[model samples]
Target: MSNVTTINPATGDQLETYAQLSQGEAFAKVDACHDAFSQWKLRSLEDRASVINGLGKALRDNKEELAQLMTAEVGKLLKDSRDEVELCAAICDYTAANGPEELADEKRDPNNAGRGIVTYSPIGVIYGIQPWNFPAYQVIRYAIANLMTGNGVLLKHAANCTGSGLKIAEIFQQGGLPDGLFTVLVIDHDTSDEIIAHDKVRGVTLTGSDDAGRHIAEEAGKALKKTVLELGSNDAYMVLEDADIDKAVGICATARLYNNGQTCIAGKRFIVTEKVYDEFVEKYVSKFAAIKTGDPTAEDTDMGPMARDDLRKTLQQQVDKSVENGAKIACGGTIPDGPGAFYPATVLTDVAPGQPAYDDELFGPVASVIKAKDDEDAMRIANDSRYGLGGGIMSKNVDRAIELASKHFDTGMVFINTFGLADPSMPFGGVKNSGYGREHGGFGVKEFANAKAIFVGAE
Candidate 1:
């Protein structure tokens, strides 16, 4: 039988072991979720709310343990990890209070109207394949959204966070959930594809890479199942000439280093106007340098180790290749020789197109600073990427910022001053290669709902 191993990315130590479900076991899980969906879907909206609300309370009650596990497993800073747990709780509350209203329909064409009601029915089990970066948030975003819509979930979490994945199942289970409401399949990718192809899996959602999203979306498509994919991102952080230099630099620094720069929306490409480029660079570099990097578990530690040894290597190679392509290092560039998987917060300046870091999602603390001659060049650079996820723009003139932000940014979510945000009420998804389908918000609820339109006889 195949086994799942949990390894500490920071210490490179083996933590525990879990067995991958056999073919029969995997099918059994699918069948269990399928069977439970029949009853789960029939339950009142309030019953669904109760379990989801319970999950939020459990997260708080066990905040210390859950957050610690996430930090140890995936290298998230302790405070941020705790915040994620709370956010998961908040999402639970958000959906419970708003889900019924969102799912309910309104009447239209009432003056000469026939009986017309648009109803949302629950689809079958939804298969979710989540990433490790923001374990709790990534899973909960999909979890609460889908479950509230009456769809069971079969999650195949990242290999590194399999332990946390199992614990997540425990949270729902202990909170008085049905057996098949949400099941974490302990298996690798080979088994994952099989799970997605299962007849009981009516739809799918994934938050990973462009490649993985494409692969899963393709497989689900082949099965005629619906898919919601949140893929890779190359988020841009821009500074215009009339920007708030201090506020801009400070927020940019925090966004970049949050989660040790392991975030998908971390400002990988920083485009600053030439008029204020030097000033932004100076303050941004000093702020980046001051960030404390050490044990993620330590309260004082502002940063943590990279998620895994391979991620450290992958980010390092991208930096080296960018330099070879003529990008200049403005700040820390080299990986310090050490036992832990730690890399210094690096910054590269004068980065042009055709370099690896220019339009790519560098899932690390490395930021590439590019200078634009004018507003035209700035927009050109920002809109260059096919991955439109989210971005940060800095300008004291909010009007100009919004104008440039709308015209320039190719991303789905644009923050005038900050970048790292995905609220439950906001519609979160990307354009182009960043993948499709919305999570959270009203649109997110419909992703798993089967909208039934009824037409009455009209004369």
Candidate 2:
């Protein structure tokens, strides 16, 4: 068997190591989870809600320790890590309070003189393959929804944050969750594929790159299992002709560099109208250059190292290729000589089609600036990508922005005038190459549920 090591991205030091489970052990856990679901699905909605509420309380109580662990694992800023814990706690609270209604049965009209009832029934074990970006939130986002829907959860978290995944399972148990309700599988990719194909594992959910999503989806498809995929995106934030340039500059900078710019929904492409492109680029570059990068545990650090050294190298290569393809580095493109996986806040202008900066998702602290002819052209440029996860529109006219977002934006989610992440009350997912199926709000709990229709006729 292999071992998964947790390394501190901020300091380039090893923190802990976990032994991977053998094939037999992993399959046994899946069997146990399936057994738990058999019992869990019979529990009343009120009983499930009580356990979920307890999970929320436990998350709040251990917020500090979880936050610190996430920072160590993924190098996110300390404040951001804390906020992630808070978000996860809120998801627990929301799921516990609103899940029953979302999954309750509904009465439907019958055409043949019969009464019809549409019931949302629980599937069996759900397997979640999550990433390390938001260690707790990513798992909580899907796990809580599945748990609330009376499905047992199995997690195959990214190798870097193995400890975080195990810790979350511990928290769930401490919160009064029944044993085997949630299990963390410490296994490799081949083992994960086998688990997906297991008969008892009814569904699969993934949060990762497009390539990984496609592979997992293919595996799940072959097994005739349901899957929910949340992939990567080079989310665009457009600055139209009537946009507030100063405000756009500040918000755009923050959006690009948030979470050290590793977010799937972070603003990667800044599509600006030619009318205000010059001023926006000037101020945006200045703001990026002014960002402070240091230890993630520090209170005042603006940015931190990436989750791993290899990720930093990939970002550097993408930037280099973009520059070679005619994109100009405005500022902060060079990698600093350091022990940790640290890359400076980078901005690449003169961006166009065919370059990585324009064509791909740069999952790092690198921003792509694309110039458009006008507001109409800006929207066209933003929609020109293979990704449709999320995008933002910066305009002084709220009504116009809303209309554009409703009618023109091709993305699954749109931000009118701000930059943000997942909200407990809003649906979160993507379309096209960014993958399908919605999570968050009330959409997630039903993704893996079986909507069965029953009809009764008088004798």
Candidate 3:
């Protein structure tokens, strides 16, 4: 039998190996999940909420141990890993509290002919293909919402974080979830394709690259299944002439470097008005250079290693190509010789079109600086990208920022004067290549639900 190995990116150590399930075994698991969903969907909404609440408590109860496991598996800072667990628990809490109302039947008027009600009925099974950056949160963001909506969940997490994925399934079971309701599939890419094509799997959701999204979307579409993709982006943050340079530098620096600089919605490009370009670049470069990279378990360490050496190499190639294409490396451009997959925090200037730094998502600890003529030019430059997941604006004028976010920003979600990860109360998703469908704020629970309409005849 084939096997998948989990490695610690921080220490270059092998953690564990999981045997891949054969085709028949994989199908059996899918059948089991479908069977569980058959019974799970019959339960009352309140009963589902009770189990989801228990899951939230379970996450908190196991936060420390799970956080440490994630850090060991994915190389995220210990604190960040703990925070990720907290965010996952918060998602459970939010879904449990709001899911019933969000998925409740809505009374509707069918052209005044009769009374109509739209019921959000649970689908059978949802297969989630998640990445390793936010291990717990990625699974929780989709899995919890689906569970609350009375659907079975199947996870095919990144190979490097297999332990974290299995641990999550264990937590769900400990929280009173029924057997087979949440299953972790430690399988190969071919097996994943088979699982996606299985008749029992109802819907698919993926959080990964645009290419991966395209592949999964194609396969799922061939099966006549619905999909929700949260792909990649080279999100831009504009610093207007009226912006507070100091505050903008601080927030933008944090946004760029958060998650060891591997976030999809991270502030990769900084479009600054000419008035503040020089000052912003100076401070931003200094901030990037001052970042402390070391062991992720260290409490004072600000940055950690990339999740894998291959990922680091890809990031290095992107940086090299960008420099060859006329972008200047202002802060960090060299890969430090180390045992871990550690890349220094980097800042690039003179970033223009025709360069990877200007055109694509870096997906690492690299920031691209673009100079714009004015506020109008800044907004224009921000929209000049194919990927539009998330972006931000920093200006003292709150009204102007709101206006840009409301009408001008071409992305799905926008941040104003601050940087944030995700909020349970806010809808999170992207447009264009960044993928479609919303995740939080009550949109996720209904994504895979069947909206059945029941009409009453006049007696």
Candidate 4:
């Protein structure tokens, strides 16, 4: 069983190679995890929290190294990588701090005949299948919370971040935790699927594309296992006539450019009202053109290359299709002059509904600008996608903003005054083709646990 290869997308350089576990090895890990889970689930929440606290400190201390690895593995800006590492550490800290109390029971009416208290308890091992874009951050959120609930974890991080994935598994082991309490199943897709399909896995958490999410969901459904899928998004950014044009432009740049536009919830479509669409477009185009794309390892780089050559080609094909369908590029639409998978930050305008760019998620530094006659049309255009994930609404009228946000059709979460800013306190999930279940806050804790209703005096 050969290991997965890790190549830097920016320079097409092989950074490090990781070995995939054999079929027998994968089964061995599951067996070990199950054995460990049998006891881990019996541990007190306080003890679990103490261990998680140790994990949190480890993350904080290794923040710089984690950031460097993150940038080297996936093509995101250096600064963004630093912040993502910090966020990972913070989530670990949060789980260690508030988890026990969050698991506490809520006030229920005691007038029910022979009623009792609701007790929250651990289930078993949580199998986390995360993507490469935000590798360290995503796994930490799932791991810390699961461990806090006294459950062991198995991580099958993306094929790209093998080094970081291995590092994560080692960190938990070094934090004085049990051997199988936190482990990484370094295996191929088939092997990983077999591991996830194992009965002892208990539950699964996935953060990836819609296609991959659907496959995992199908397998989990067949097993009758609980699954939380944070799937892909074709999010829209709506600009009302009364929106602060300059502020909208600035935030839009950051929202779409984050992760080199590889984010599932990156603002892909720009639905702007016609009255001020021109002004917004002027500023937005200017900002897009000014973005500096370069080496992800460089500290001064604002934009990094596409995560892989295949993804870059796909992005280029999307841009080509849009242009062929009569869409005009306002800023950039081609790969930059380099050996890496670097593409310039692109802005498309006059993107008619029939254009390829209008219907598909241009999963790169490409934003399609659509014209809307009014707020009604803006919301209409935003809700026209088959993918209902996340959305953004920039407006001056607070009430209208709320109303429009509430009225969005194919969206799960809508953000006002800014783009999608995910927080551990917020309930994060998607609707429609974007998949189901959440990965943050109280919702996340329950995803890995089986809620059993305890009733008494009825026998």
Candidate 5:
């Protein structure tokens, strides 16, 4: 069997290696998960929720260890890693408290029947293909929802964060999850396809690139299995003519640099109106250039290395290609002399079509600044992309911004006058190239459920 080795991006140190499971072994695990689903789906929602609630407690109890593992494997800031664990715990808590109501049966009126009832029933096993950006949160986001919906969960986490995936499973078991109900598959891409083809695997979900999503969706479609894809995005954050320059600077900087700018929903494009374009770009560059990059474990560090060497290379290539296509570097464009995969917080100005910065997703600590003639042009530019995942609108006019976000901003989620991440109460997903289906806000629990309609008539 082959093995995958994980490295610490901040230190270039080999952390650990995990052996991949062969096709037969992976299939056996799938069978075991299916067998466990048979029993898990029979349990009452309250009973399943009780176990899920314990998962939050277990996560908090081992928060430090999980955080450190994440930092070592993915080069995420230590503080960010700790916060991710807390977020995972919160997801568990939210799913446990709100799942029953979301999945409860509903009564409906029928023309010919005395009464009609609709019930949300569990399907079967669900396989998740998650990324490494937020290891704990990514898995917990979908796993807890499906588990609370009375379905079994299987994970195929990014190879770099394999340890985090296994640790999460261990924590679930300690939280009283039944054995084999939540499994982690350590296999190659070929084996993963086979697992998707397995008849026992009822559903598949992925949070990765759009290309990977299409491939997985095609395979699942051939097998007639359902799939939920949360893919990549080049989210735009627009600064309108009436925007508060100072506030926009701070919010936009955080939106781009958070998680070292590896977030799919993090602001990649900055569309600023001509009224405040120069002022916004000046301060934005200062903010990015002033950022301190160092060891992820250091308390003073604001940004860490990218998750891997290849990711850094890909980001640099995009930046260089953008510059060659008429985009100009406003600040911090060059790669520093370092042993780690460290790319400075970069800003490109005069960004327009035909440039990677304008046309594609720059999945790193790079920001593209484009100037629009006016507020209308700013909104037009924001919506002029194949991606519609998440974005932000900066404006002093809260009412106008709200109206635009509610009506004109063609994205799944939008932040008005601020920068933020996913919330347990809000539905998350995107449109177009960003993929489909929704998660959170009680939407995920129904994604794999069987909504059965029943009717009764008086004899």
Candidate 6:
């Protein structure tokens, strides 16, 4: 009987409400998904690819509606929502095109000189616990890859984006996905835990905070289920002495504010060499100050409100605590009186180890600027973090940046001279407290698969 409501963060207006599913009902849903998987897992990989191709088309056919709903639900810019849908569609395309080959059985030589076959077989059902940011893409990122592997998928999306979750299921069905193959569970945490322990759920994946990841991993561990976690980050972007200051400024500015600064892999810390520290800080603060914050649906708006009131409040408190601990605000430190959960773009300087600005992931449109003695110091500071999700290196010397990224950077993914997000062709995930495992770039297809080995005696 309990319900969850979605709101427009830009206007503080209620959008819709969805009733929560009971624990028994959620378990039944899992059973139904497993039943569907019984049949789905028997389908040819080529057939699954065809259905995935249709998913991409279906996403494109309904991109506008999906984008609008996402913007309303999470306060993401309209344009960004459209781009997110496109990215999701592209993930489907990439999976469909590459899945058959990636999941195909491989021949291997055994010690007995017999033929050994390694087959990537689909696990039963995969349970995904997703966040509100990048609603469509996050679900598609794991869901499509698993579907291509011939597994059933269950989504427990963030409560704020419940509608988006159900809509996505509808779209998959429209695209020829089998019934119960892709089910959305509108349930509370207790039910989610039960679902995770369900006999039908073969694996689990989550995109959320490090604390949440740790909890989920522990729970999944108890059940002896595999888990893939993509946790939070305070990703650092370094500006080297040989960097083009202008390009670095622009790229870092966009990277820091992308997805309204909700992206887990976004550039949150700006570590600049002493040579360009003044120049980069001046330009970066100015750019942050100029980014227009308003209604998410407006074309002229450069930034949208934070996803929720409590999230905005938490970000403000982090900024306040950071300042009290020695960090200084260069611009936008104050919370403005507004109708919605809006916070202006903020920049903090003199960010040191003790402050939240230096040590934590500020999951909002806030930037932390740190000064380093030189390129060596900047690299040292960048690699000092315990969270190694993603980071960037900006330098005029492309070769040196590549070398540094290849050898020195401790993060999972690195960007040279530019800021970037996830790509269908590249693997995404992190190490350290950012959690483990990988997704995308064909890695996701096997995350929950069983690579059974069969050997045939030589004739």
For model 2, residues 94-141, the per-residue Cα lDDT tens digits are 998999899888998898747889898999999999998899999999
Candidate 5: residue pairs that collide: none
Angstrom error of the Cα, residue 439, model 2: value is 0.4
Candidate 3 lDDT, 1-459, residue by residue in tens: 688898898989999989988988888999999999999999988899999999999999999999999999889999999999999999989898999999888999897557899999998999999999998999999999899888999999999999999999999889999999999988889989999999999999999999999999999999999999999999999999999999999999999999999998899999999999999999999999999998999999999999999999999999999999999999988999969999999999999999999899999999999999999999999999999899999999999899999999999889999985899999999999999988999999989899998988765
Residue 416's lDDT in candidate 2: 78
Candidate 2 collision pairs? none
lDDT of 3: 0.94
Ten contiguous residues with the weakest lDDT in model 3? 107-116
Q: Model 2, 389: alpha-carbon shift in Å? A: 0.1
lDDT of 6 at 163: 92
- Report the candidate with higher lDDT, 3 versus 6: 6
Model 6: per-residue lDDT, tens digit, 1-459? 599999999999999999999888888899999999999999999999999999999999999999999999999999999999999999999999999999999999999867999999998999999999889999999999999999999999999999999999999999899999999999999888888888889899999999999899999999999999999999999999999999999999999999998899999999999998999999999999999999999989999999999999999999999999999999998888969999999999999998988999999999999999999999999988889999999999999999999999999999998786999989999999998999999899999999999999988
- RMSD list, candidates in order: 1.6, 0.8, 0.9, 1.9, 0.7, 0.7
| Clashes found in each candidate (C-alpha, N, C closer than 3 A) | 0, 0, 0, 2, 0, 0
**lDDT string, candidate 4, 397-426, tens digits:** 878888777764567788888878678788
Preferred candidate (TM-score higher): 1 or 5: 5
Off by over 4 Å in 4: 105-113, 407-410
Q: What TM-score would every model get versus the actual structure?
A: 0.97, 0.99, 0.99, 0.95, 0.99, 0.99
Backbone clashes counted, model 4: 2
Instruction: Report lDDT (Cα) of residue 261, candidate 2.
Output: 92
Model 4 weakest lDDT span, ten residues long: 105-114
Query: Which pairs clash in model 6?
Result: none
Model 6: weakest 10-residue lDDT segment is: 333-342
